[model samples]
Each structure stands twice: as structure tokens, then as C-alpha cells.
Target: MTKVLVLYYSSYGHIERLAHAVADGVRQSGASAVIKQVPELVPETVARKAGYKLNQNADVATVAELPDYDAIVIGTPTRFGNMAAQMKNFLDQCGGLWFEDRLVGKVGSVFTSTGSQHGGQESTLLSTHTVLLHLGMVVVGLPYSFKGQLRMDAITGGSPYGASTLADDGNGGDRQPSDNELEGARFQGRHVAQVAAALASANIGATL
Candidate 1:
């Protein structure tokens, strides 16, 4: 079975929720999905003082294990229109894999959450895609086929770049992903899995 990894760095639970939706979408394609998180860089003492969600139970992703997957979908909260430092830190550790060309031909995709409607969701996704390209990975993205992407009547977060969510609730509520955002994540996951499976099959064919 094609193995896809849904890796993310979620300070709160917003990205975590979206990561689960993406994993669910990958499973819908009969692929094996592993959902994990980037290691926290913040000091434990400081994290507790700031009330960061340190209790997240997801397994931590290691650079050595990245080459084991056929596809990788990464999620992160936007930090100044880019991925959070924690996620970037994790990817920075994978230079060994890039040097070995271990991730070449693997499928890669990105998802992100922003604090507001125009909070650089697309920019975050694009930035992540740049790293994937540098690793020689095949990048996948959400197509216009996902009808949820075209919803302008109601506020939603999704674009051709990838799945996204608005972390801020309009009514001064806590940060969380909306239902539409989760659906967008699922669509991205399913699409990436499908593409990865095809690529895996093609690779096997070439070897035969």
C-alpha cells in the first residue's frame, strides 16, 4: 500500500484537526496514512507560561523517517505569511535526505491556517512547496474540481494552492478550523494520495 505521512506543527489544535481530516482523506483512497507532528522547539517552561498546547499526543516526525513515505502532506499555522519556525526547523533537519536524493519522486503537498481571511494562507503553502521542490519531490495541489473552493457567498478557506483554514473565529471565539476548512483539508489529502499512488505504480512499472 502507498504510505502517506501527514506531518504538521500545530501550536493549538487548529492544525491538528485539519491534519486528521487530511489523514482521513488519504485513508479513503486505501492508502496508509501516518499523522505526526514536528518537534516543539519552545522551552517547556516558556510553553507552559504561554498556555501552548503541549499535550498533543501525536508522534514526533524524524528526519530519518521522511524517506520512508511515498507522500508527505505538511500543515502549519502561518507565521508572518510563512510556516511557523517549528515546522521550518524540522524541515531544515532533512538536508541529509536531500543530499542523498531520498525524497526524489515522492509526492508532497502543504496545508496551512492563518489568523484571518487574508492571513497569507496561499503564501504559506507556496513557501512550503518551494522546499519540497528543492528536495526533488513531486508537488500536488488542490484543483478547481473541489467545489468548496469556489464558495464566496460564505467565508471559507481553500484555494488551488492547498487546503487552508482561518484560525480566528469571527465572534471573538477561540481559534479553530471551520467545517469548510476541514472539508478542504480532506480534499487535499485525497488528491495527494491519488497522485502518490499513481506515481508509485508508475515507478514500479518502470522497474519491471
Candidate 2:
């Protein structure tokens, strides 16, 4: 079976909600989706004081398991125009996998949440893509086929880069991902999973 990993780091649950939506899309395409979170780097007392979503249901993911999935959908809240340090740290530990080229040819996708409409959403997605490319993965983004990104009537977060959402006021704000944003995430998930299933079923790299 085609397997996908929806890996994310959410300080206050905004990206967590989007991650589940992405997983739902993966399941829509008959692929198994496992959602996991990166380890929190903040001290436990500081995290609690900041009201981080410490009780997130997803387990912390390990670098060793990332290669097991046919596709990986990454999510993060933009931090100064890039992925959060927690997620970046997690990926940084995958040098062993990169050295082995273990993730070569796997599908990779990314999503993000920002505190404002212009708060580095695209940059975050693009920068993350750089890592995926370095790992020799085939990258996928939320293409125009997902029309939710085209809606202009509301203040929403989404782009050709990937599925995204605005995180309300700031890191700890209460605003959740809007319906259009979630739909876009689901669309991205389905697209990535479909592509991975096709590649896996064909066993296309057998030439090696």
C-alpha cells in the first residue's frame, strides 16, 4: 500500500488542524496517512507558559521512520519567513538518510501557517522545498486545480506554493484554518498521495 506521512510542528494547533485535513485527503485516495509531530525544542515550563498545544495526539516522529513513507507532507508555522526551528531541527537530523539517499524519488509536499497574510508563507514553503530537493524527492505543490486558492472574496491563505492558512493574530491566537484553506490542504494531500501511489505501483525506478 502507498503510505504517506503528514509531519508538522504546531505551537498552538493551527497547523495541527491543517495536518489532519491533509491526512483526510490522503485517505480519500486510498492511501494510509500517518500524522506525526516534531519534538518541541522549548523547555517544558516555557512551553506550558506559552500555552503550546502540548497534548497534541500525534506522536513525535523520528528521522529513522521518514524514509518508510512513499510521500511526506510537511507542515509548519512560519518562523521569521521559514519553517519553525523545531521542524528544521528535525529535518537537520536526517543527514544520515540524505547520505544514504534513502528518500530519493519519494514525493514531497509542504504547507504552512503564518501570523499575517504576508507573513512568509511562500518563503517557508519554498525554503522547505529546498530540503526536499536536496533529499532527491519529487516535489509537489498545491496547483491551480484546487480552486479554493482562487477565491478573492475573503481574506484567506493559500497559494501555488502549497496549502496554507493564516494564524489569526499571532502564534498563540485563536483563529483556526478557514474552510477554503482546509479544502486546499485536502486537495494537496490527495494530489501528493495519488502521485506517490502511481509511482509506487509502477515501481518506476527498477531500472537502477
Candidate 3:
């Protein structure tokens, strides 16, 4: 079976929820989905005091296991228009993988959340894409066919870059990812997995 990894970091549960949604979408496409998270950098007491969601269910992911997946869907909360330090730190550990070209020809995608509607959501996703590209992975994104990203009916988060969600501008972390945003994530997951499955089945790398 084709395997995809939903790798993410969440401070207040927003990205965590989206990770699960993405995983569900992956499964719908008949690919195996595994959800994991980067380790928290904050000290336990500090994290608790900062109101971080300390009870996330996903296990901490190691950099070594990333190459096992045929596709990887990364999620993170934007920090000043970029991926959070925790996620960056985790990705930084993959220098060995990059040097070995271990992730080349694999599928890669990204999703993100921000504190406000215009808060660097696309910036986060796109910058992350650069990393995936450097790793020689085929990048996939949430295309317009999802429809939810095009919706102006309500305050939402999503784009051609990837699925996204908006936070409450740090107003106590009240704004959660909406159904539409979750659907966008699901769509992204399914889209990426389908592409990865096709690539895996094609075994195009074997001829190269």
C-alpha cells in the first residue's frame, strides 16, 4: 500500500485538527496515512503556561522516518509569516536525508494556519514548498477544483498553494478551523495521495 505522512506542529490545536482532516482525505484515496508531529521545543511548564495544547494525540516524529512515506503533507502554524521554529528545527534535521537524496521523487505538500485572516498563511506554505523542492520531491497543492478555497461566503482559509485556516488573531485561541477549511485540507490530502499513488504505481524512477 502507498503510504503518506501527515506531519505537523500545532500550538493551540488548530494545525492538529487539520492534520487529522488531511489524514482522513489520504485514507479516502486508498493510501495509508500516518499522522505525526514535530517535537515541541518549549519547556513543559512554559508550554502549559502559554496555553499550548499539551494533549495532542499524535506521536512525535523522527527525521529518520520521513523517507518511509511515499508522500508527506506538512502542517504548521505561521510564526511571523513563516513556519514555526519547531517545524523548522525538525526539518533542519533532515540534512542527512537531503544529502543522500533519500526523498527525491517523492510527493510533498504543505498546509498552515495563522493568527489572522491575512496572517502569512500563503507565505508559510510557499516557503515550506521551497524546502520540499530542494529535496527533489514533486510538490502538490490544493487546486481550485476543491471549490472551498474560492468560497467568499464566510471567513475561511485555503489557496492554490495548500489548505489553510485562520486563528483568532491570538485572541485566546478561540477561532478554530471551520468545516470548510477542514474540507480543503481533506481535499489536499486526497489530491496529494492520489498523485503519489499514481507515481508509485508508475515506478518511473526504476527506469531512471
Name the Cα RMSD for model 1.
1.9
> Which digits, one per residue and each the tens of the lDDT, describe model 3 over residues 39-126?
9999999999989999999999999998899999999999999999999999988999999988999999999998888889999999
Return the lDDT, model 1, position 94: 87
lDDT of 1 by residue, 1-208 (tens): 9999999999878899999999999999899999999999999999889878888889998999998899999999999999999999999988999998888889999999888899899999999999999998888998889999999888889999999988788665676777877988998899999999998887841232
Encode model 2's per-residue lDDT on 1-208: one tens digit a residue.
Answer: 8899999999999999999999999999999999999999999999999888899999999999998899999999999999999999999999999998899999999999998999999999999999999999999999999999999899899899899999875655578899999999999999999999988878963221
Task: Let me know the TM-score candidate 2 reaches against the reference structure.
Answer: 0.96
| Candidate 2 collision pairs | none
* lDDT winner between candidates 1 and 3: 3
Model 3 whole-model lDDT (C-alpha atoms): 0.93
lDDT for model 2, on a 0 to 1 scale?
0.93
**Which parts of model 3 have CA positions greater than 4 angstroms off?**
169-173, 205-208
Better of 1 and 2 by TM-score: 2
* Per-candidate RMSD, Å: 1.9, 1.7, 1.4
Model 1 Cα shift for residue 123 (angstroms): 0.9
How many Å off is the CA of 141 in candidate 1? Answer: 1.0
Task: Sort all candidates by lDDT, best to worst.
Answer: 2, 3, 1
- Model 1 alpha-carbon miss at residue 75, Å: 0.5
Q: Which stretches of candidate 1 lie over 4 Å from their true place?
A: 204-208
TM-scores of the models, in the order given = 0.95, 0.96, 0.96
